[model samples]
Target: MLNVDGKVVVLTGASSGIGEATAKVLANNGAKVVLAARREERLRDLKSNIDKQGGTAVFKVTDVTSHEEVDELASFANDTFGQIDVLINNAGIMPLSFLHEKKIAEWDQMIDVNMKGVLYGIGAVLPYMRIRKQGHIINVSSVTGHIVNKSWAVYSGTKFAVRAITEALRQEEAKNNIRTTIISPGAVVTELANIITNKEIKKGIEESMKISLPAEAIAHSILYAISQPDNTAVNEIIVRPTNQEI
Candidate 1:
């Protein structure tokens, strides 16, 4: 609908969940997708499926936490596709825990993957996008960014940082003809909850996930943002299940 045909999209965390679904949706709509994730096998499998469906795709194994690796991902996308029209920073982890629990390692992990990862993605592609004079950067946030819940202090902080970063990027890059978007999604069925070590928190997340939307819902939102005309910059999209109160 937005005429995304022939656009080149680079997506991180593309092995599963929102990243995987977004890859399929964009590719099906005629966008050339470059998938990046830590899991090489999954990336390969996803690329194969996209190709089987008559979509163009290639994959590069990457960890978004590493600035160098993220830079390489951008380079690989440019090398393979000639130019990148969009960069989707979708790789993130959600290991919700109470501060009193003293899960320092988990907190550090969240900061590294969620906050620093998004920054690294932007750093990696910003130069390229600036050079191109037309590109889009999509960062995935969460509803927790808007409202801090009981056990989501650190997680929410990370997502909130994403929103701030994307907004700043939008303001700064507008002159360069680059668009930025922050996608904040509520609970959805994904492997993000599996990383929660706190049993009580995991149980609560499981219950909430029972009524969640599929990953494709967020994928569709990403597609809509990317499909918009060059003059239209869809800055932020908040998508939640109809029954989700939060």
Candidate 2:
């Protein structure tokens, strides 16, 4: 490991699933974790647990869809921790529905939460990282980002945009000493599937969940990426359960 001890890490979507898992993993490894999410109660609970484990942590209630709130989150982390070593743009939503279903509202929600949210997080942290000339940005994508499936068009589009954005960021910030990583996971057991409004799609996802990897699996991958030496940037990691074919 590259000694992440005392490193300041700011993680979005810290209330549940992969975000919650990553917070615990990083905090236990000695990182000062700043947790951000819309749910204040959940964030507080998570922070308390981390403290109980002798890991340092703090929480900020934030809605990633709002650029202002996201900016405040970054500022909060910096003000509280003194510096931010990493920013994890892990907040997202998955509401799969066929295009013909005309779930325009759901489509908009996904775009806002999944695509725009990632962009806002980057915008919030890039300036601070650029000034420091040392930081890492991790964005969560999905296997659907690589290959679209039925009723997953909009969801996949958002993830694909995430991949594109992360790669471009990696290229642009490399000389500035800012590392970028994209984590693409396949069917991890999380609350993401609950957002699917389409009956058929929800059923399909439930069936897939039976063999899904736990959120901790993705958290381990994140730890691995951030643990690398400054000169080595793990650009992309695609993780899935052994039983998963996609």
Candidate 3:
């Protein structure tokens, strides 16, 4: 919590799962957290909960698919906190199926939210962070980003893209005092499985999730990454359940 305290963090997909858990953890440690997602009611409720725990938190209803909304999210955080110390591009979706099944809408949704969303977040905060010469960008990837499963082709592709993007940002911005972190979590308990329409794939995922880690597990990894000294960039973390094989 050393480097994490008193930082202003803008987190997306903050309504549930990893994002929500991370927001609570960071705020509890004295980070002024801006929770962003499309669900206003959820954001409001989360903000209230954080407030109850004596954590600094704010809510912004945002759709990661829209560039304008992400920019506004950044500005809102800046106007409120006076400085943006971190951006967590944690918004994403995983709708898995065979390529032949042609879940075009789901595929498009993944690319829009998983890939473009991360890009927009980077763009939103770069100018300000560069000016201050200090910031951190933590991107939530997946274990699938490092390995492709039978039905996880497209989802894996997007996650892989996240790793690539984070690496590029690190190479380009480390000189400007911008730290980049890629968090690749494996089979965390989340609602991500609810969106998988393929019956076969869903069943398999559910079985595998019997050994899943809690969302808080991933959040702790984030805490470790951000709590590192400012000169140390915790570049990538791949967290899988101890029993997880693939």
Candidate 4:
């Protein structure tokens, strides 16, 4: 219905949550989606479901933190689909804890997966896009990037980095007909809260889950952005439930 049929889309973080949902939505709308994530089983399951629905999809086991893996996925998409029109950098991790607690490993993992992972995705696809003079890059940030909270120092920092990078990428690629879009979701129910080791923060998020929107809501927003005409780029979208305030 959105005129996105036959487009090749390479989506990271496609094993579950928003990534899985977006893969389904885009495929149903006529995109050939290449799913990538660390979980091979999950990817296979999603691929099967998409195929059963008469949608085109494939899976590549990818760890977005690994540049080699990300590059391989891009190559696979191009080889399989002939071209990749969109790269959705949706792989990220959010493990929140007080700075005072000094959970250095969790902090590092968030930085690697949330910030560097996005960079790897871009690095993998930008060259092809530049050569073709056309492509779309979608980065998933969070409202916390704009409004930080106590236990979210490192996680928020990574998201802020994503926002900044997406904006810069947009400005640099405009001349090449390459579009960059950022989706800053406030609180859609997902496994993101499972990483929060901080008891208080975990409790708060669990209680708030009652009002959080489903991952499908964010998936639809992604489809909306991707459906826009090539010349009309929707730069950024911020989605949140009506009940969520800060």
TM values, all candidates = 0.98, 0.98, 0.99, 0.98
TM match of model 4 to true structure: 0.98
Q: How close is candidate 1 to the true structure, as a TM-score?
A: 0.98
lDDT of 3 by residue, 155-230 (tens): 9999999999999999999899999999999989998999999999999999988999999999899989989999
Model 4, range 1-246, lDDT digits (tens) per residue? 465888999999999899999999999999999999999999999999999999999999998878888999999999998888999999988778889999999998999999999999999999999999999999999999899888889999999999999999999999999999999998888899897888898998899889999999999999999899899899999999988987
RMSD (CA, angstroms), candidate 2: 0.8
For residue 101, model 1's alpha carbon misses the true position, in angstroms, by 1.2
Q: Which regions in candidate 4 have their CA more than 4 angstroms from the true location?
A: none
RMSD of each: 0.8, 0.8, 0.6, 0.8
Best by lDDT: 3
Model 2: per-residue lDDT, tens digit, 195-218?
788788899999999999999999
Candidate 1, poorest ten consecutive residues by summed lDDT: 1-10
Q: Local distance difference test, per candidate?
A: 0.93, 0.93, 0.94, 0.92
Model 2, stretches more than 4 Å misplaced? Answer: none
